[model samples]
Target: MTASHTPRAKSADTVSALERGLAVLRSFSEDRPQLGHAELVRLTGIPRPTVTRLVATLVGAGMLKPAPVADRFMLGPGVVSLARVFLGSLDVRGVARPYLQSLAEEVGVSTYLAVRDGMEMVIIEACRPRTSMLAARLDVGSRAPLPVSALGRAFLSAVDEPQRQQLIDSLRLQRGPEWDSVAPAMHRAIAEARDLGYCLSLGEFHREINSVSVALIGPSGEVMALNCGGAAFMFTEQRLREELAPRLRTIAQAIAHAIGGHLPALP
Candidate 1:
């Protein structure tokens, strides 16, 4: 199931112009870093004229700038500035980085710490084994799908029941016909997380990748997750379950203890 870049307004007080403008910005991604008004309109479902106006305003506000190519625009310094502020505010990243790096080096794999964003998990900290040539090609801003990714399922296991159900309902709506096929695996992942303090994604998110993840809760109850894995050939389901999952759980506990965070109780 594909997630929408544009968010739906949940209330009557929503400012549609602001929403549309944000949608225009959200249309830019790692794969599609630059877009023209026509592209924005197509991706965001906004009218062309509205997209044009939004682009003009965004460019004027320093949130976007013309790309090297004619009529195309890319996210600008303003977005970077905002991202810096957001990253700066995430204290957990600071606490988790060393542990993540240690795990990556020890396991000869990649490790990531992420938080939920709508129907996806956004990586805040990504670490790789410095001595190893093989690692997952993901960085701080990379996103993983909620239902299919171990990181995302671990996040689901961390949240309260109401929030989890709300997110699931939203996923159902977003996935449409695909929900039937996706639900069973997602439920299984959730169950694993609840039962074992971790979740596994064996070639579910990317057919070539396998990962295991554990959830963390901050002292004030903020939710986050950590995942470790690499190429499918190196991280088989048995290896993940027997070898990596225990270490991953230890790192989760260590991070939680360091940050005064909490790990979900296993049943």
Candidate 2:
């Protein structure tokens, strides 16, 4: 998923039914809780009969379940079950395992990979050293808000200024339960990160955890980040500045190389 992996040229081929079927499945969301055949036809602009057939097929396949209210369908346990398997197979951990281990070993802390997910970053992989003090046990699926975590700032640093500003504006509009006091400082942090090569969060996301991060852009220019984290007392400001930041830049460059693209100059 990095610059080293060139993307295949787009094909002019027609859309496949399977692709359309998946799109139909994706069209339903929390807002549009239940969908009927006619509603799906209106939403997808697919023919009514085809929508009906696909809905029936999906229902039979257990990807959709009949709603308690008559004549509606909702996403089923089958989708959740399949999605778990898919996420487990994503292999970000496999790709980042050695690098994260190396980073942890060098820094004597823990490292993690977090991918941007809408308004938050989801921790996809984590490598922790045996001796490091952990303020929190960040599991694979933990979600962290953008304004609080170094992983978010690393991603924000790589994005264009306009998008970064927009996300900051959005953050100003909403505040997390624990972060009302920290939001303004986080805004400054984001701007600072834009100026600096990377971002650092010092006990901002969690009370006793500190993290430093650098961004990685994939071959398609999609942004991801690598974050090294530990107890704030152990991962001191001096350590982040004098040690961890330099090593993170090296790991990110390696990831970009492995992923394939025109690599950006290291900051």
Whole-model lDDT values for every prediction: 0.88, 0.74
Per-candidate TM-score against the hidden true structure: 0.94, 0.65
lDDT of 1: 0.88
Best-matching candidate per TM-score: 1
Evaluate model 1: give its TM-score: 0.94
Candidate 2 lDDT, tens digit per residue, 43-152? Answer: 66667788788888889999999999899999988988986896787555577789998877766777888888656787888888777657457767666778778888
lDDT per residue (tens digit) for residues 1-267 in model 1 = 132766586579898889888878888888899888778877888878888888999999999999999999999999999999999998888888998898888888899999887788999999998775545688999989899999999999888899999999988888889899999999999998999999999888877889999998989999999999988888889999999999988988988998898899877
Q: Give the Cα error of residue 112 in candidate 2, in Å.
A: 0.9
| TM-score for candidate 2, residues paired by index | 0.65
